[model samples]
Each structure stands twice: as C-alpha cells, then as structure tokens.
Target chain A: MNRHILSVLVENQSGVLSRISGLFSRRGYNIDSLAVGETEDPTVSRMTIVVQGDDYILEQIKKQLNKLIDVIKIISLAPNVSVFRELVLVKVSATEKNRASITEIVSIFRASIIDVSNSTLTVELTGDQEKIQAFLELMRPYGIKELVRTGLSALQRGDTQISQTVTE
Target chain B: MKAADAIVKCLQKENVEIVFGYPGGAVLPLYESLRSSSIKHILVRQEQAAVHSASGYARSLGRVGVAIGTSGPGATNLITGIATAYMDSIPMVVFTGQVSTELMGRDVFQEVDITGATEPFIKHSYLVKDATQIPRIIKEAFHLASTGRPGPVLIDVPKDVQNDRLDYVYPQDVSIRGYKPTVQGHMGQIKRAIRKLRNSKRPLICVGGGILRSKAQEELANFVTKAKIPVVHTLMGIGALPVDHPYYFGMVGSHGFAHANRAVSQSDLLVVIGARVADRATAGPGLFAKNAEIIHIDIDPAEIGKNLGTLIPTVGDAKNILQQLIKGITSLATDQWVQNLREIKDSQKDVLFEDRVGVNPKVILKTLGGILEDTAIVTADVGQNQIWAARNFPVTGKRQLLTSGGLGTMGYSLPAAVGAKIACPDYQVVAVVGDGGFQMSMFELGTMAQNGLPLVILLFNNSRLGMVRELQNDGYGECFGIDLTGNPDFIKLVGAYGFSGIRVHNDDQFADAMKTGLAATKPFLVECIVDPKESTL
Candidate 1:
C-alpha cells in the first residue's frame, strides 16, 4: 500500500463537499485525512486529501474525481517532492510533578505552549505527520486530556504554481 | 420582473417549445406566468409521465426536453423518469416546484429536498434560493444537460422565490467555473485506432445508443461504408442504422441472437462506438470478445475504461470522431470475414423464435412490422415483448424507437408515446406494451383521450410479467410473482377511458384493428393475445 496526497481543485458550489465524500464511501475507499478551504479565487476551492490504498484504488479515485463536474483538477503530490504539514493541538495534564518535563518536551519538538492552565497545557504543533505523532507520544504519559489534529494540506516544494495553469 | 416570468423567458431563450408537466398549489406562480406564455404546456396525468414524455421528446427530436412537477409526492414521482433519462444519457431539463423558502426545512405541506434526493441520478441539481439567480441557473441547467454526455439536470424553484421580483438578466453565454467537457478526440488516439483497424484481419464495429443521441448516424454510416466492418447493435443502439442493412448483425448478449453473439465472440478486433460495454451487451468481460483487442470510443470520458478495460480508448463526440475515422481509414477486403459471418448468421437464424402452438409474439411482431410505416415511432414497454421488438421491429429511416432501455421500466411506453406524438404531431406514433407491463402506467391513456392525441397502442397480452417468468423458468423451475392470470380486460379498460379500441387473438383481426385505429381521430388501443411460454429473443 502507498500513501497518496491528492490536491484537488473544485468549483466552490453548495453540497460539493458532501458529494466528494459521498463518492469515497460509495466506492468503498477509505480517506485517511481531508481538508478543504476556499482558494485565492473565490469561485474555486482546493481540497487536500490523504488516502492509503493500492495503485488500482488510487486510479479508481482519480477517475471518479474527474467524473464529478464540480471537481476541476487533481494533482497527486509525492511525499518526497512535496511539503506536507498538519496543525495539532495536544492538551496534556500539567500537574506539579510533570510540569518541567512537559515544557522540555514541548521545546524539544519546537511546539509552542498555546494555552496554559492550572491543570493542563495545550501545545500547538504544526509539522509533517511524523513530527505531530512524535510530539503526541511523549505527551501521552502525562495523562493527555484532549487532542485535535487538522487534516493534512500539502504544496509542491518548487515554484511550480497550481492555480493559473489549472483551468481548461 | 416576476421571477416566474423570468424562468419562462429563460426556457424560451433555450428554444423549448413545449413542457410536459403537472401544475400544483406550490407551483401556482409559475403556472400564472405560463398562462400567457407561448410555450405550450401539456398537463400530464401523472408526474412520472411528464418526465417520460420529455425523454421520448428528447429521443425523437434530438433536443433537450423539459419536464416540470410540483413538490413532495409530485416531485418524488418524477424520480423514475429522471433516472431513466440519466441511465440512457438522454438530454432533459426537469423543473420541480418547491415549498416556500421559509417552510423548506420546517416539514410544511408539499416540502421535499428534491436536490438531495435525486443527487445520484441528476447530472446537476440546483435548489433556487434567490429570485435573481433564476436566469443564470436556467441557462446553466440547459448547457449542462445538452452538452458532452447528455443527461437530465434539475432545478427546484421555491414558491416564495418565484413570487419574489427581480430584474431578469439572462447571460449571453454561460461560463461555468469547472465543467468543460472534451468535444473532440485526441488526434493521436484516433490515428492509433486506425492503425489497429488496418492491421486486424477480423474487425467489428459495436454500435450503441450514443450515435443517435449525438446525431451521428450519417457519419457512422459513412465510416462503416469505408471501413467495411459488420456492425452489431445494443438494444438502445438499434435505430443507429436500418434494421435491414446488409452489414447490420442483430443485438448482442443474454437475449441477443445466436449469430450476433457468435460474431462478437469470434471477432479478432472490436471497435466499440457510443455503446458502453454493459454486462447485458458483453455478458461478462472475460467471456466477451476474449480474443479481441477492444477499442472503445465514447463521448463520456468517465465511461472510458469503466466496466471493461480497453486496449485503445478514443474519447470525444461520436459524430466528430466518426467523421475523423472515415477520412483516416482505407477500405480493406473483409470478403472472407463477412462471408464466414453471413454463413453463421444464416445458420443461426430463426432459432430464437419459432411458430409455437400458442400465439407467438414473434409472429405478432413480424405481422406488425409488415403493417407499420417506415416513419412510425414506436415507444416500447419493458418485458419479453421488448426483446422481441428489439430483434424484429423494422426500425427504418428517421422514425425512432423510444424505450426505457436503461431503466428497464415496465410501464414506460404509453406515457412516453403521448410525449412523442405531442412533440412530433405529424409522425405516426405507437406504444407497444405487454399486458402486465401495460397495467403499471396504463392510466396515462386517460391523458391521451382527454387531449384527443391520436396514438396506436399495441398491447401484447401474455397474462404475466413476461421477463420475470422467463427468469423464473430458467432459475427457479417455476413461476410465482411473474404470473398475472386475472388481468383486467385491456380493450375495455382503454374503452372506458373513451378510446376506440379492440381485443384480438389472431393476425387478421389484429391487422383490421390496427387499420381501423389508425383511421380514427381519437386515440386507439389494440390488445393482442401472446403465448406466455415462448421465450423472448
């Protein structure tokens, strides 16, 4: 199995998000992560979706995406050639016993302590999948209370733009 | 300007002459505007017929047909008809009146989320919230439904939205953000396909319904004449060429002819145009044309490599690609291949239909074929009789055969023919239906009677759902739900509705009944007894 991060450009139309997600479920394909936001052009939106499937599954998804009139274009960015990132807010228990250790761990991972309270510390981390996972593992022993991670969004490393050349 | 008036104006801009629809309380404002509009609205007996008639109109006229229905059950009833058009890729624009904007989600009277409900079947759907957006939405709906791989697009206009006033400014040309369809095949792909055809010793052209939809019949004929390839028709593709054309090798697959099936199986190279290689046409990909290098040409890019893989896929409009192919190809001697297939075709003939002890549908179709005009449009229902019509019905010239081929809709014929005759009043229109299938939507006869639309309805009485019985015979060893021995007297049923009709059990009376019916000013119905045991071709 290979991990594919597909950057999809779609028309900013009502119920388009539901339609795309419905397609995944209808085709029996699993979506690991997905993030959608309005692009620079108000009429269009970009979707960053991460999926883990075989080559056949990837091919099927790509073909299905093109079939949706709302979907304009899709670029499957390779991990090695792309810059991938995810924002994660990990709130860990910060009792007197483990306060110092938690701060050291946060500094080591280059994560900022966004919220600090009497009982917990909410660490905001933004990086690739590996960096987010590593930060969460070290904070796990402190009796982590809550966690929320944004779905992956990626861009090509070089200055090869996607917007201007996307339209037919 | 009133939003409802603007909507009508937009339809007029699209050159829609008639609309098959039913007016209800929620849709009063639109009807109020339509009262004075030049666009003729045919009030159908039911919402289902409205859509079916639109489909029949689209099929015969090669134009985007329009259907309208009120919200809730009225809109819900149009689901099957919309789905039928979607499955067949027929171009249609369906407008369903919605509840007032405020009562949309409050579950007020006659409120339904039509856009959400028909998402799968609809090519595109819009829930109109603002009155000002009507012109753009209507224009876009027309553009989407009639372009590329044509299908049904729907717009749900809320009653309150229609009542609201706005300055109507219809766009000069639509500019959809992300919906451009490829209209021309890549030249490289076309060249590659031509090279393959030139090399293959046994080449076959598999024709589908898209040719007729694209108005590519002349180009297909031109291509075939130069290529000298034997063409096989899928059920929906029957009218692509004359049924009696020397190169035409009948329909293919499950109920397909033995020789036609053999022709596909034995061919070394298959050039499939317009036809999606459906399971009914191919049986299964593995067994179907196992040795053939398949070249699939289609207008829909989505359909390419779908269901069955192809060696070379050429995507574009059927007419454009066919025209290109005609210019690129050089005629080769397929004398041996044609001779061999003709021998097999001759040997395999008359095996599917035999003159049985009872009233065989084969003889009925044969006799009917001899009687009907070359320019008569026959709307056929789904049953065992459908297969018989598909095989034996002499589809000649411009007169088309319209059916719920994709949806396999049982009660489709009568209502659709009403739409067809209304659209093309000059042409002779007929509805060929089975007894069990006839009863499903037979009430549409009242609509025909009320409007005084002259139509010839040929009802084949088998006293059962013929296809289901055939399936039961093949798999279960006996029939259950398929049998309907206590069917109502069909002729009397139509007669009570004020139609001049007859019930016949033989050819002589059948001919006389048809002749008399055709001569009448009122809608005519002829019910003929058919053998239930005989298998459909």
Candidate 2:
C-alpha cells in the first residue's frame, strides 16, 4: 500500500464533509490527511485526500466516492509529478537552555516561530510528509505540549490548475 | 393563507394519507398545520427511522412514501436512509427543514445544504425558496418520485418558507424543462427484438424491479407465457413471475440458484426487463452473460447498458414495450431449449426443505403462500428469509413482492408492509422478515398500530442473522455480531403497541399462527422461531 493524493471537486454545501468522512469511518478506512478549500468558483470546492490502499481498491473507492451526488470530479496525482505539503502548528515548552537549540532546529527545517511566550514557543511549519515527520521527530526531544497538523494538500508540479481542465 | 395550510393542502392534493416524521423546530409549521389535516402522521422516535419507514411504506404501498425531518443533524441522519431508498429505486418523498433564507449563508444554527447533499441519491431535488412554490413542488416531487423508474426525491423548505403566507393553489400540471420521461418504445426496435426472440433457440427472460414499478404484472405474465421462455429474476425481480409458474427458474446472483446461473451461462438469447444487472447480481463482469445476446428493455434509457452492456436496448416501460412485443412476436419451437432447462432444474434440485428443527424456510414460505390471498403484496427483507421467500412464494394474480434488491437493505420489510397496507387497505399486506431484519425495523409496529393498519408481519426468528452466519462460514471463519441473542420478543413488542401478536414454536403452530395474524382486523405480528442452521436458498 502507498499513500495516494486524490484531488476531489464537490459542490459547496453543509454536511458533505461529514458525509464523506462518515463513509470512510463506516467503511473502516483510515484517512491520512484531508484538506478542503473553496475553488476559484464559489459554488464548487476542492478537497485533497491522502489515503493508503491498493491501486485497485483506491480506484474502486474513487468510483464509489464519485457516485456521491455532491462529488463532481476526482483525480489521483502521481507522486513524482506532484507537490504536496502540510501545515503543522506545534506549541512546545521551551526553557532558557532549549530555546537556542529549538530555533536552530526550526531554521534547519525551514520553520518559523509564529508565536513565542515566556514559557512556550508556537512554531508554524509547512513541508511534505517526510519533512513533517522529520521535524516532529526532532521536536520530540524538546517536549511538544500540543501539535495540530493539516492533511496533505497537493498541487501538480506544472502550472496546470484543476479548474482549467473542466469549466463547469 | 398560511404556508402550513398550503403544505396541508399540497399533501391532500398529492393524496398522501400517511407520513413518517419526527417533529423539529424548522418543520413545526408544517406539523402544526398537519394537526388539522386529514393525513395521518406517524411520529417516529428518530429521523433516520422516519425515512426508512417511508422507504418501507413506498415499497409496500405501490405509491410515493413521504418522510419529514428537521434541519441540520436530522437532515444529515436521513442521508443514509435516502441513499438506501435511491439505490433500491423505491419511490419516496423526503421533506426536510432548513434555516430561514436570511440565515442560509451566515453559518447559523442548524443550517445545512440538504438539497446538494441529497441530489445524487434522489431522482430529483428541490429547495423551496418561496412559500408560493410549495404546493407545486410537492405535487411535482410526488409525480417525479413515482413515475417511470421510481426513486426518492427531496424537498428542503426553509423555516420562513414553511411559515410564509401564500395562496395555496395546487398546480394543475407539472411542466419542467428537461424532465420529460419517454413512455413509448420505438416500432423498429420492438420489431427487431421480436424477430431476434423468434429466431433464437436457447431463449431466457430476465425481469427486474421495473415491472412492479410500472404495475405491468398482467402484461408481463401474458408475454412470458406466450413467448414460451424460462424466467430468471434479479433480486428485485422476485414475485414479478410466479414461483409455481412452470417456466420460473428462481433468482440469478452470487447467492442465487445454481440452475439460474447455469441458464444465464448457457442461454443464447437474453431478454432483460426493468432491472439493472448490478455487480452483486452478475457476480463479476468477467463471467456475466459472456455468450448471451442481451435484449435490454427499460423505461429509463440510462439504466440500459449501464452495468452489463446491452445489444438490443428498447427504451420504454415494461408493460408498454411488452404489449408491443406481444403484438409483433412470432411463435418459435424451443422444445429442445425447454427440455434442457427442465433437465438442469432436475439436476440442481435444491435440498432446502430437508432441514428440520423448526419449519424449513421454503416450507414456511409455501405455507404462507397457501394461507394468504392471491392479491397480497408481500414485502420481504434481506437475509436468508428473502432468499427462501423468493424461492418459494408463488406470486399469482394481483399479488406482488417488494424488496430492496439494489440496496439489499435490512430492516426494510416491516415499514414497507405498513406502507403497503396503508396504500392498499383491501389487499393483504405481509412483511416476511428475518429475526435480525425484523429487529432492525421493529419500531414500525407502533406506527402500524397507530394508523390502524392491519399489516401482517412474519418474523422468521432464527436467533441469528442467517446470511451473515453463512458468510462467516464461507469466508470469515467465525460469526461475531451475527446473532440476535437478546432480541426483544416481537410478539410481546407488538402486544405493547396494542396490536394482536402470535408466536409459533413448532411446525404445527405455523399455519394456525398465520391464520390468526391474518384474521386480525388490527395490526399483528407473527414471530416464528425458525431453525438457525437451515439453508433455504
């Protein structure tokens, strides 16, 4: 099994997100990461999903998902030809001794400190799955009090946007 | 004039006598108006059950079933039920409440996009923006839901729209652009089909759910007998052809009869009726009717060549198309074909009746057939009971069988039987449900009692979900959540609903119990404690 990045287009409506998620939950399939946002058109929205399954199973899943009324289009992006990233906001407890080291590690991981208090440092990081995993592992030694990660949101390597393919 | 009054008037115009629903803040207006209306409202414990009950009602009643729910969570809860009905092609109208128009995009409390969420599942959907449109939309929703190939429809009315002041003028006609369904078949295609059937040696007839939807039972029977072809039914096609009918060969599916599959594998010409060749029915696309020249007939053009591609597709209702075909058909000598089919039947003789602990499912079905009237509409649930009834119930005369073939939904029988009883009060309505299936829809017993509908429910209490147990035996190696170990006493439950109920523990009591249940002028439940290990299909 491999992680597949599927871009789905659906009508902008309520409970659709819950319904889609409920389907995965009911089917006993674990979702790795999911991100949904409004498209250029207000009526339609795009959702990026990272799920691990066999290619055939994934195809069947996509077909079933496509059968949902709100879902308009679903396209699986090739890993090599796509750029994927996830945003994670982690708040870590920092002492005088670990502050410098944490800042150095954050710079190495291309992360920025979004918020810093006397006792805690909230770092905002954006990277691919592998990079995010590496950063989280490094931050493990330095006490991560809280961490929230957005699922993989991907775009094709080239300038082609999903909107250009179908006008509707 | 008030919107609530308009809603009541709309329901009266549509001829809806009973509706399954739960009260909600957004729908209070309609509910308030319903208090004074002639329509009987069945207040379900949950919104999801309301929709399921409506699905059951539609399948049993042979008309559009109505269900109502509130905004947000209530609407979302109805999604599964609506999808179930849609998948099964059971006609139903689901009414849901929405936040007022002003609160629609403001992220207000209890606001959801019901129309968009339900559009894919329903045959059609409407969002009532103004109260003036309620009457017309309600009329059209029922019309679209019941006509041609049936399916569920949704009408999401905002709180303001439900309470708005508008003159209630029921639409004289429903005229919507891009919504004309074709009713008649092409003469050329009809002639071609007749010519092909006449020329073929190994001919077979495959009827789907469309025959019942179109109420073309007489035409189908006449055509089948005149054509002299063996009939194989999809799960949805059960009861369209009588089980005792000489040419009937049971069902065709993964769980279908061995002889039926062999017939499909061996037949040269296949005449497919209203039902679609679903993946579950065909086993797999690779082994499905590989050699047969399929002549697919359906009212909906999209269903034709959808699953297994059709060779000769005739687009029209089953009755109309069959009537035309009957006129144009030329007689063929298929003595060899008939002999081969009979031989296969003899070779694949099912040993379902040999099992004895309680009454064999096949025997129970046959017994029920003998006891019930010929004009009864039998609604069956999924599981072994469905298979057994499909194999044994010899549907004849005006009687019909209703099932959730496409969805294969459990807990379908009780509510559907209740609905059917309401639709045809004069006709005997029986719901043949397995133990697990009956438990899933047991709440409908109260609804039946409340409405004074004398619906006969036959609960095959095997203590286990027989189909799931079989699946475990075949694949899982263990049956986990398959048993109804602590299930409520169905008879006691019905008694609590103030209806007469009977329990049959032995084979001798089966006929008597059935007679008592049928004789009751009020709703009744007959729980027959059946043998769990028995395989009826």
Candidate 3:
C-alpha cells in the first residue's frame, strides 16, 4: 500500500464533515489523517485527507469522493509537487538538570517552547512529517507527558490553485 | 404567505401532479396547505408505502416521484424505501416533518434527526432552519432528485418553519457549483470503446436499470441491432429489450439462466451499460468475465471500475453514450457468436418440479405474462416471487417489471403497484408477491380501494420464505424461521377490503383466474398455491 494526499474543496455546510467521514467508513476505506478548515471563500471549505491504499483503492476513493454532491473538486497532491506541514504541541517532562539540553534541541530544530513550568516545557513545532518525527525522537529521552497534532495540511507548490483549477 | 403554502407553490412549479403521504402531528401545517391545493394527494396506510408508491410512480412515468411524511417514526419508516430508490437510482423527492426547532435536540415527542439518519443513502438532504429559504430549497430538492444520476433527495421542515411567514418565489433554474453531471461521453473514450467493439470477435452487451432510468431503451436496441451484439440484462434491466428479440439473452446472475451466465463467461469482450456490475449480477466478481475485456458506460464515474475492471470507461448518461456509440459504429461480424448463443439458449430445457405438490410459480408467471397486455406493468416483491417474475414474465412492447433489486425490500410490490396504477390508469398493473412478502404491505389494499384502482394482485402462496428456505436447504442443511404457517385466507382478506378475488390450486386454473381478474373493474386478487419445496434456479 502507498500513502496519498488528497486536497478537496467542499461546500461549507453544517454536515459536510460528517458526509465526508461517513462516506469513508461506509465504503470501508481507511483515513490515516484528516484536517478541514474554511477556505478563502467563506462558502467553501478545504479538506486535506491522507489515505493509505493501492492504486485501485485510491481510484475508487477519489471517484467516490467526487460523487458526493457537496464536494466541488479533488486533487491528488504528489509529495514532490506539494508542500506539507503539520503543527504539533508536545509537553515534555523537564527538570532543571535537562532544561538546557531540551532548549538546545528545540533551537536546533527551530521549534519554540511556547509554555513552561518547573517540571515540564510545552514545545510547538510546525514542519514536514520527517522533521517533526526527528524532533519527537530527540525529545523522547525527556518523556512526553501530552501531545496533540493537527494532521497534515497541504498545498500545491506552484502558482496553480486547487479552487481555480477546472475539474474534469 | 405562509411557508407551508410556499412549499405547495414550489411543488406546483415543478409540475408535480400528485403526492403520496400519510399525515401526522409534525406535518399538520403542510397538510393544511395541501388541503386547499389543486395537486392530488394519496393517503397511504403507512409512511413506508408512501415512498414505495412514489417510487413506482417515478419509475413508470420517468418523472421525479414525490412523497411526504411526519417526523420521528414517520421519517424513520421511509428509510428502507429511500435506500431502495438510492440503490436503483430512482428519481424521487421526499419531505419529512420535523419537531419544532427548539425541541429538536431535547428528546421531545416525535423528534428525530431524519436528515442525519438518511445521510448515507440519500442523494442530498436539507434540515431547513430558515423559512424564507423554502421556495429555493424546494426548487433545489426537485432539481437534485431528477437530474444527474437521479436518486432521492429529502427536505426536513420543522412545524414552526412550516407555519412561518415567507414570500413565495420559486427559482426558475438551479445552478449548484458542486453538482454538475456529465451528460455527454468523452469523445476519445467513445472512440476507444468503438475500436474495442470492432476489434473483438465475440462482444456482449450487458444492460441494467440505467437504460430505463435514462430512457435509453430505444438507443440500446438500435445499438444492439446495428452492432450485432447479443444482449443480457440485470434483474432491474428486464424491460430494456423485448424478451423475444433474437439477439437478447435472458437475465444474468446467480438466479439467472444457465445459458446467459455461460454467454457472460464465454464472451471475448463485454460492454456493460448503466450497471454497476453489483455482486448479485456478477454472482462472484473475481471470476466474472475473467477472460474478457470490459467497456463500462455509466453516468456515475464511481460505478465504472468499482467492481469489474474496465478497459474503456465512458462517463455520461447511458442514452447519450449509446447514441454516440451508434453514430460512430459500423456493423460487426458476430453472426457466428450470435448463432452459438442461440443454439445454447435453445438447447437448455426449462427446469421444472413435476413431483412437487402444487402449481409451479414459474408456470403461473409465464401464463400471467401471456394473459396480460403488452403494455402491462408488473411489480414483484423481493424473494422467490421477484426471481420468478424477472425470469418467467415476458417483457415486450412497453411492459415494465418494477422490483426492489438492490435493497430487496419485501413489501415493495403492492404499494409500488398502487403508484403504477395511479400513474398509468389505463395500463394493467399486477403485483406479484409471495405469501411471506404479501402480508408485509397488504394493508395497502385499503389505499387501492379508496382510489378505486383496478389492480390485479397475483399472490403466490408457498407457506414459507421460499428463498431463505432454499438457501438453508442448500447451504446450512437446516431451516429455522422460514415458515409462514399461519398465513391468512388471502381471498377473504381482499373481500374485506371491498374487492373480489379467486384462489388457484393448479396450473389449469391460473390463466382463467388471471383472465377473470383482468376482466374485473375493481381491485382483484388471484392467489396461486405454490409448492413449498419449489426452488428458484
């Protein structure tokens, strides 16, 4: 199986999210990650979905997604042609002894400590999947108390916009 | 003007002549509005039958069927009918009353989130929060239900919204940015399909209900005759081609004919039109047409490669795609292939159960097929009766067989027949149902009587859910809850509804009973005793 990123534009309606998620579960397709937010146009919303499947399964997913009446357009974002980022907040257990080392590692990764107490430091990081994974690995020695992530949100690298493209 | 009156005005704007519904507390306001309107209303015994009847109306006339019900249980009851229409792509617009907006989430009396409940099956739905949007919403609902790959759309109106004041102005046209359906096939794909058909030595065309849904039967016939391809159909595709057509093979599936299934397996190339190649039609997807190249044409792109692998995929209306194919096609040299299929079809003997106790259901259906007019409409309920009608009933001229093929809802035929009779009063409408399924919606007999519909109800009594029993006997080696031992005397039941009926015990009695039933001016029931051990092959 291969991982694929789908950028979709849908009508910004109350139950649009449920319709998209319901379709995935009903069709037995697995969603690895999903992030949705209002688009530039208030009437439309953009959904970034990450799914893992073979070519046939991916094609079926795309076709099925297109069938939903609220869904306006769907574009597959290839890794090389798209910019992907995820924002993660990690609360690491910190003592006075290891505080300097944690700060050093945060600086090295260009991540910032957004919140801090004597026992723990909360770091906020935004980067590609690989960068975030590496930072999390380096912070493993300090012990992560709590963590939350906004799943991968993506955009095409070129001037072409998903909303502007004419869907076939 | 009141919002409820505006809703009625919107229906009028859509040219909806009739609606099927059962009124309840939540929809009282809308019912009041309908009371003074010119459009006719059918009060079904149950809310489920309302939707089924509407489906029958829609399928028979190629129009968007309209049905209404109240909130909570009323809306819940329409779920099966909605799913049935969705599965078969029947065009329908359904209305459900909602609890007052304030009481929606409080678990008040008669409150249910119907739009949420039906999201998976409905084509589109709206939970109306603004009364001022009623005219626009109703217009959009009709457009969504009848356009593109047609299916059911729903509108849920709270009682307060129904009574709220609003200026009525129905939209003249619909333009939804997210919902444009392809009406014309891609030229390149059409050419590729034509090339594939021309190159193949043995080509077969498999059509489904989409042909009827798109009103493409004539186009399909012209294409078949021009291309010299043998045709087969799914159960829902029964009326797409005349049963006596020389190039037409029988229905194809597990319950389908052996010769038809063989034709599917042996063909070198398959052109599947308007069908999703569902599991019931393919029997087993992996082995279906394993050696054949496929060309799939459907309005919905999702159905193209979902089941069978397609070498050429054409996305458009079936009628439009078939028209394009006809325009580009030259005659194929498939005389030898057609001859081989004809020989195979001719050599196969009709499977019979001579030792069984009662009259064979297949023989009864065949006799009824012969007795009925060429333009008759036969609605068969799910199970053995459905298979019997689909296989044995000869569909010629404008004859149609309406069944709940996808969801296989048992009580569909009786109410659907009611709808068909209402849609085409001059045409003969018959409801072919098994004993197990007959009791499911027999209450609709009152609806028939109230409307003075002259319908012929052909009831096959086997004292069991024959299909389930057959499965148990073949697969599990034991039967459990298939028996309907306490089934009522169907003739007397009809008599109570102010209708006349007859009981047929053998083959010789069926033709005469059918003739008598057809000759009667009132609703007539002909109950045929079927053998308990008779199997659907």
Predicted structure with the largest lDDT when compared to the true one:
3
The DockQ ranking, best first, is 3, 1, 2
Q: Scored by Cα lDDT, where does model 1 land?
A: 0.86
Clashing pairs in 1: none
Look at candidate 2 and give me any clashing residue pairs.
Answer: B56-B416, B60-B420, B61-B420, B208-B275
lDDT for each residue of candidate 1 in B1-537, tens digit (9 for 90 to 100): 999999999999999999999999888999999999999988888899999989988888889999999999999999999999999999999999999988878999888888888887778888899899999999999999999889999999999999999998889998885677888999999999999999999899888898998899889887888888898988889889887777888889787888888888888999888988688887885677887999989888667677657899888999999989999999967879989889998877564555544456667777777777878898899988788788877887776888877888877898889888988888888899988777888778878988899989888887878788988888999888877878887777877988768878766676778888788888998877877777875
TM-score of 3: 0.99
Off by over 4 Å in 2: A1-168, B105-109, B352-356
Instruction: For model 3, state the Cα shift of residue B42 in Å.
Output: 0.7
Model 1 reaches what TM-score against the true structure? 0.96
Give the DockQ-based CAPRI class for model 3: high
Give the least accurate 10-residue stretch of model 2 chain B, judged by summed lDDT.
B349-358
Best by TM-score: 3
Q: After superposition, which runs of candidate 3 have C-alpha atoms over 4 Å from their true positions?
A: A166-168
- Per-residue lDDT tens digits of candidate 3, residues A11-105? 99998999999999998988989999998899999999999999989999999888888999999999999999999999999999999999999
**lDDT, candidate 3, B1-537, per-residue tens:** 999999999999999999999999999999999999999999999999999999999999999999999999999999999999999899999999999998889999989999999999999999999999988888888888988899999999999999999877777888888889988999999999999999999999999998999999999999999989999999988899999887899999988999999999999999999888788988776778887999999999898888998899889999998999999999999999999999999999977668987788888888887888989999999999999899999999999999999999999999999999999999999999998888999889999999999999999999999999999999999999998988888889999999999999899988988998898899999998888899887
For B1-537, candidate 2 gives per-residue lDDT tens digits of: 898788878888888888988888889888889998899888876677787778766765577889999999989988878988888788889999899998898878888988777755677677888788788888888878887667888999998988889876788998643355668998899988988998888989888788877877778778878878888988788768777787888789887888888899899999998988888679876577888899999887666655766789888888898899888775567778878888988888566445467766677788888888988988888988888887787787667887777777788777777767766788888889998888777766667877788878888888998988988887878888887789877667777889878887776788998888888899877877788787756
